[model samples]
Target: MKVAADHRSGNSFLDFLLSFVADCSKFQSGYVALIGKPNVGKSTLLNGIIGQKLSIVTAKPQTTRHRILGICSGPNYQMILYDTPGVITKQMHKLDELMMKSVRSATINSDCLLLIADICHPPEQVLGTLDEGAVNLIKSKPTLLVLNKKDKVKQSEIQKKQEWYEKNSGMDEVIPVSAKFGLGIEEVKQWLVSKLPLGPAYYPRDIVSEHQERFFVSEIFREKIFQLYREEIPYCSQVNVVRYVEREAPAKDFIEIEILVEKESQKAILLGKEGKALKTLATAARLDIEDFVDRKCYLEIKVKVKEDWRKNEELLEHFGYSGKIASASL
Candidate 1:
């Protein structure tokens, strides 16, 4: 009986030692920045890779203002994805400059890069789209040229574009994918895993992102603005969550939001005739917020004129554009 008990203890110790060795030897983790021009589906690919809508997506260009972190963790790896603002070569306003700075910050922090391109568009040099400040940094890193929107083009066109990027883009690899349709996404993931350095997991295995709930709530409202409005309305607008309260089950959560515009004319347009437009926006935003948070909530929206806020560097920094990329707009 004593020998039998000793044998059982030895077997248990061996199992524990093997488990620890497997966990230590197999882990891979690193930061990856998704870089591209406006409307190139960077956010779409991020959402596809993370398998969740962490970054907001729209048909309009320059929808993402800040650098959002989307964390995807598997059993053996954790990929921290930076869904960055579209890098614009032209710096028109203080906000645009700050956004480019955000892009640079993400690029510097990331271990590798995903330089996305639109296959539907002509085969232009991907590095040419990044600002001069970020070009050298991108070149220094291992970059994968993701030719997105492959679903929109024919198979032959896809092959031609893929070959073109491989020949001219100077990227480590060229992957043609339809981020919107979930095609070639696994290849993208596999490439990322290979590039990521071997290390311990950066986040818990079940966690998907590090952003606060309020940041995403504001993004949801901003996305509705982009979808429902036209012309300069979405571009000139900013959404901020003023107050968020979590209540008990009998009472719904409470959220108060503000939308900032540059002019009274823009405010009037946002409100629409007799406030009907704002009501439509609120209803749409509220529904999406409920879905995002997985709970019912009361939403209050107000439109204010900030008078060229985009040009105001002080205000732009206050909105979390300069350095604190993930700060929730208070």
Candidate 2:
């Protein structure tokens, strides 16, 4: 018997040719916006789907303040996932409006939307229902009802929430997933791919996100703030990377970061007794920064009291939260 060297057979040359042909076939690519209320695991879900830490995840709400784009490419599909800030219930400061604007911008022109809801809450809770802003955003999009944190809820509760969303919300599909544990993520990816139109890859296959290293570096420092602080401290704080200097081989990279707070008391709190707190925070952040840049990092963190910085338009823009709501309007 003669062995066949064809594409369908176990032939390396023919297999490579067939794979190339498949790559050149019609590919699905589009932007998907992940919108939800605070602590709904939007960041976690995005990181889980993309298989990287593109968005910072903390136990606190509103950790994501801008529109973050994370790209995930497969053999035949490329998903540009937009992880926006959580919907703000009350626009307290200019920063709040800016965050909401990000959500709006992310929703506009998106190929698909994932409204992630926390299923662990009871149906009567606000978490059970989508906010007006979210509802309006979902009305005209190919939306998917993603009930995240499925691991925290019972099967009966999951069914109830899914049924409620299916009836009350006009989502095309309802998926239950635990972003932390990676359950039902494959289904989420499949649904996103199904909704994407046939097109060429939007970004390079190896690229995970469009943000530069400084953006992620700032987020890492902010994540530490949220992790270490309590009450209104984290919410009132913002991290700014003033100088990020990279040196050649055999030289350690230096990063100078400033943590801005609204009051001197907050600044003192951030510095802690004899700057011990800041030192601990810097050490923790440096370890992660080293891992991210794959180099030895010397991180310098300072606390500054920028009184009412959240309300200052110039400062907000400097902080990169210039409210661009009008630009997002359709």
Candidate 3:
């Protein structure tokens, strides 16, 4: 993806200041959860901030289902960002309820909250007057309001939304950003570093996320489903990595994944006429998975019907939504 080049560069005075700050005793580290309604560019913002894509992105809403942790560490600070599922006002299924549970857990566990809103659309049209859960969380935490999609909106419009958030939401600060074009990202980093509490690094500086390789592999397939299919196909489907194995020397890694659907008709839709659609999806997903693992992969994909799996607690747990966000150092 195209992004802005780093503006911080070689200047004797700036270098001296950075070195001085790095050597200071006041270092900062903590978790900051990114919370907002669906399709508000939360995943895109996280990818831009962390300088990598840990969470999947699509035009479709509710693409992210779990709490994904993206770590950003500098010489004197480490900010662990949690990209959570969008907070839905109405829980339509057991899966929706589980996703909301993740939002609540991330909000409660984080040291600071980053609430994002799409500035290209009206607040009521994009975020829809804050939900009670969101309102309570904002009231309780040190929150930052982020106006995303600034590249698509005018400065006057952005300012209007910023003022509206300041008045209605309990946000401590407002920062306008364009996640796609990398506008105002430096300001966001500086603000986060200032707000973070003084503490040691929670994760190793080299690592970018906490999830396993298999988890990302499944997510890649799920993202392909979202990108290729339409209507209820993406919503009623889930990807599970049933088997994953690594090999040495002259051998390729092996991965077996199952695409679970709620009905037989959905399976047919995914498979497509003459299995052309499934082949296309598998090729795209395999390429991404290979790039992620840095190895050639032999992938096996199958479609299965698991009626009402979203509402089944057992199935949900098996799919890795354990009804609790795993504990992380804040």
Top TM-score hit: 1
Per-residue lDDT of 76 in model 2: 84
* Cα lDDT tens digits for candidate 3, 266-315: 99999999999999999999999989899999998889999999999767
Q: What TM-scores do the predictions have?
A: 0.91, 0.87, 0.87
- lDDT of each residue in 1-330, candidate 2, tens digit only: 122445446677666666655765778899999988889999999999999788999999888897888999998899999998887678899888878877877888698899888888654333334466656767777888899999997898888888887787667888999999999999999999998987778788889988778888888888888998899998998888788899986889988888889998998888899999989899888999889989998887768788898888767776667532111100
lDDT string, candidate 1, 1-330, tens digits: 144554568787677667756776788889999988899999999999999898999999999998989999887788999998987878899899888888888999999999898999988877876656678898888889999999999999999989988899889999999999999999999999998888778787787888778989999999999999999999999888888999988789999888999999999999999999999999998999999999899987778888989999878877778766333444
Please tell me which model should have the higher lDDT, number 1 or number 2. 1
Q: Mind sharing the TM-score for model 2?
A: 0.87
Error of 2 at 97 (Å): 0.6
Q: Which runs in model 2 stand beyond 4 Å of their true positions?
A: 1-25, 124-136, 323-330
- C-alpha RMSD values across all candidates: 5.1, 7.4, 8.6
Q: Where is model 1 more than 4 Å wrong at Cα?
A: 1-24, 131-133, 325-330
Q: What TM-score should be assigned to candidate 3?
A: 0.87
